[model samples]
Target: MEQEGEVPHVLIFPFPAQGHVNSMLKLAELLSLSGLRITFLNIHRIHQKLTLHSDILSRFSRFPNFQFRTITDGLTPQNRTLGMFSDLIRRLNSITKPLLTQMLLSGELGPNPTCIILDGLFNFIVDVDAQPKIPVFSFRTISACSFWAYSFVPMLIEDGQLPIKGEEDMDRMIDGVTGMENVLRCRDLPSFCRLKDPSDPALQHGVTQTIQSLKAHSLIFNTFEDLEGPILSCLRRRCPNIYAIGPLHSLLKSRLSGEESSLGSESFNNLWEVDRSCLAETVSQMVNDVMENKRNELMGSVNETAKLAKTSVEEGGSSFRDLERMISDIRFLYRRQREAIH
Candidate 1:
């Protein structure tokens, strides 16, 4: 039960992958900075790797209310590369779900977590029990463009657009995607769209996740409106409550403008080692091209992008306002629960 004047707590569970953890960790830090008590849940395997690579504990230690909790992914010491999500999901249903319930009921994890921010892929876990219930929001650590592309698979299949006939059909233009008709093509769709077999697990994963998102209170994406406005507009028709505040790392980084705010911000934990040499080579070529192309003519747009990230999460700022709304909703839920209990 929440105490008087106590900050409402939020439980964050990422998909246990490098990119997912990196982006969500940044969001966790952002929320902690905003005065919410945060409980970051991690799979032991991924958490182990993250600890080995970076000072995750010491870094998050700055926030007294921030803490890490780990559950087993039920995978071996081996890395999860392919067909691993299936096992992870099975373990979640059998192991983690019950464990989460136990934790919530026992109050062992602190005052009942007011809300759960679950990964979009972990669709099976529903509302947790309390006097009322813990509201769960699904956070997809992917671009709105890719998410919207995956969500269209079922419609494309019904209309005979997916499962391309052959190489000849690869470059064919795709239609009926409400906002992406001009930009999307057969080859441009997610790799899952290329699977001709309906029973294929990878393809099925996309379908299930997209369909299950409707069950959540809100759909959150680490993408900003300027980049995915059209897709977000279409998404809102389905989920209705969608938060697309992203380039999240940059957004959070911009907010920590003080000199001391630089601590641990540089650690972007990557499970897959980044090939900086290839990156450097590509960046060098891009620099030469940009220097010659006079992209300074397009500098206004670049500055606008930077300005958006630097904007505080105030009434008008995209991320600032979305996060404020989230906190407000959770606090309201907490108050209702307290009333019911009393």
Candidate 2:
């Protein structure tokens, strides 16, 4: 437990996927640096992935303010190989809430957490807040545009456009989704939204559960204004309490000392292990094929446009500003909580 006057504790729960876990971990690192006690929670399977890499384990273990914990994924031990999206909704619903409740009640972790930060994908965490005193914040791990696209799923369905029934129907062009023009097809929406069966119980359960959960808390997207100006505008109008903080890698890099930053190249999450020789040869051939295709596509047609398209979010951009804002908000919340208790 922290000293009485120490910083407030915050619990962070990332979606059980490599990309989402990595992004959320970076945010946790930033919060820890800002003098907050952070408990970073992962599903058991993902925790196994991080533990398998000794380098990653040693690095995180060295941080006193940042700790890691895991809860069961509700999969039988033998069925652990199933991918994250396979039966994900059921597993999360079955396990996370009870596990979190037990953890909060145990009083054995760090100081009691002031708030819970959850992955936007698992909006169910918002509904799990039976304790009115502990605030909840939704953390979005994907691009702002992708988050915006997901917000439209229900509207699209109501208008009789989505839940496309067959493979053939997937290729039909979708019209009138705001800010997105000439989307390739309904099939182009994220994989979860393109289910072939409208009556799929798991699909319906996951979608409805996630959408309903969004109504429970404030939202934070891992993106920035400049990178997604139009989409951010749309989300702001739809959800007022939205925060865009993203490209977390940049914010983390800025906080680390030079020596610590040098170690940042170490891989923190590798769900699959590949033999080096075979992987290298395969990757080289794939890169050559991709380069040849890109050359054909570009063919001297406005090189600047292609350059702009290829820009990264971490080049001191919108994600950077949002990180600053998120850290500030967390600090302010912690201060307010302390003042209330006193």
- Clash number by candidate, in order: 1, 0
Q: Model 2 TM-score?
A: 0.83
TM-score of every candidate relative to the true structure:
0.85, 0.83
* Tens-digit lDDT string for candidate 2 (1-342): 346447778899988777888888777876776677889888887888777743556666656777888887787666655464556566667777667777787875567778788877776644454766777887777666776666667777788877775666767887767887676377777666667675666466546644653564567776656567788787777666677665456556645644445455534556556445667778879877777967755656546533333343344555555566666676677778878889
Worst 10 residues of 2 by lDDT: 305-314
Candidate 1 lDDT, 108-161, residue by residue in tens: 778788888888887665443332377788998878888888877888898988
Please tell me which predicted candidate would have the highest TM-score against the true structure: 1
Q: In lDDT terms, which candidate is top?
A: 1
Error of 2 at 27 (Å): 1.7
Clash pairs detected, candidate 2: none
State how far residue 325 of model 2 sits from its true place (Å): 1.3
